[model samples]
Target: MEGIEEKLVVSTADVLDYHSILEAVKDCCALFCCLDSQDGYEDKMVDLEVRGAINVVEACAQTESMEKIVFNSSLTAAIWRENICSQKDVDERSWSDQEFCRKKKLWYALAKTLSEQAAWALAMDRTLNMVSINAGLVLGPAVAKKNPLVTMSYLQGAAQMYENGVLAIVDVNFVADVNVRAFEDRSSCGRYFCFDQMVNTEQEAVKLAESLSPLISLPPRYECQGSEVYAERLRNKKLNKLVEGTAC
Candidate 1:
């Protein structure tokens, strides 16, 4: 866990600026592209998520010192709320429908989905070495606070997504481990769905709701009705193999 704190160099610049991103990645052996906008509804979202991705890939493409880039993406980038009901068992192969997100007012989800897609496309076009970690709602301590929605709104939405397996949960530590493993293990290819737990049963969902109580608003306990939370399953076979058969 000893990061090169002394080696760290700070720079204040815009993520969308290709030159600034290029400068940031200078002399880096590996780049972990884990940038996205929490505001899903604005022009800034497109600028930060889509354009920023392009800028980073462009910078990494130009940087000879860079080896591999680990892109931290999200389950939102893979699941659309509309498709959750109709679809069966969404996994790493799934991509949230852009049209669906736009139609339903899921701006943050759309931004993430588009951002990840653009990165994949540009990475392939440029032939850059990269791996994406499509993580669930990650919980952990933070020196830098996440966006405003990281609390109630995110938890509420995640509760709904959990019903249909559109959302899951993971510890920040576990997510970090996945990132490092994916980087060290050269054979790790494509996208890895990283989550510690997918609350697929009604009982489990209810427990989650009860635990988060006043922090998040969920339906009344009686309103839950049944114990069957069957919409889709999130699979990570490759992730298990990478983690020495410790399945999540």
Candidate 2:
């Protein structure tokens, strides 16, 4: 399929800066996808993201031709109910509690929740046609360069969760594909969860890692078990219907 026009790729060197962001969105449609690792013990990273998103939305509203906006949120924004374990169904309505996030020290979840909330609030206030794509752990072919934190903390060790489990994983390519589709599809609105399958334990992660890349050493199975904070059962009926009419 033909790719999006190069003119559509509005490069903003300073996404978090208000003046710079506003300058980038002038006379153009904007799609803002936010991804940062504030997981584990990090405290203020999430707040930074929330502030940046607000700035971006404000900037976009200033543009005369800015038509739509898309925010990449996460499944972490939802709350997983332990008491309702028997009920496997999950959807966009589920939300992760900020208070619980503070207690558990799940910086990633907190960041996602806060950033999404800020975006929603701003979108409502500004009356911007915005949508957020909430997804699970994204995995695919490794990028050329690997950083220390990504290589050691997140990629190498599988000693986090112990039982139960977290949400599923989506390939990075699938993520990019869906993102482009979301912007092109006029019917796209609100939050959409993206994950191919669920990975419950470190054992399962190791298996997946081995299959995806045989060279990498798999860590001992550990359970980073967390409740499925967001519901995974979101109807992609709109997405499907849109894709049918347009190129993916």
TM-score to native of every candidate shown: 0.83, 0.74
Model 2 agreement with the true structure over 1-248: per-residue lDDT tens digits: 36757544545447568898876766776665665653432677778878887888888777868878878877667643333234455566667778877776666677778888988898889998887777765676663123223222233222322122444567778778778877887777777776666666445655566655444655566454543233333333434544566422
Model 1 — which ten-residue stretch has the worst lDDT? 143-152
- Over 135-245, each residue of candidate 1 has an lDDT whose tens digit, in order, gives 877766641145435434344356567766666778889998888888888777778888888777777777666555555457554676565866557777768887983
Q: Relative to the unseen true structure, what is the C-alpha lDDT of residue 210 in candidate 2, on a scale of 0 to 100?
A: 66
lDDT score, residue 33, model 1?
75
The TM-score of candidate 2 is: 0.74
lDDT of 1: 0.74
> Model 2 segments beyond 4 Å from truth?
1-12, 37-41, 79-87, 143-165, 201-203, 209-248
Query: In model 2, what lDDT does residue 108 have?
Result: 66
- Give the top-scoring candidate (lDDT): 1
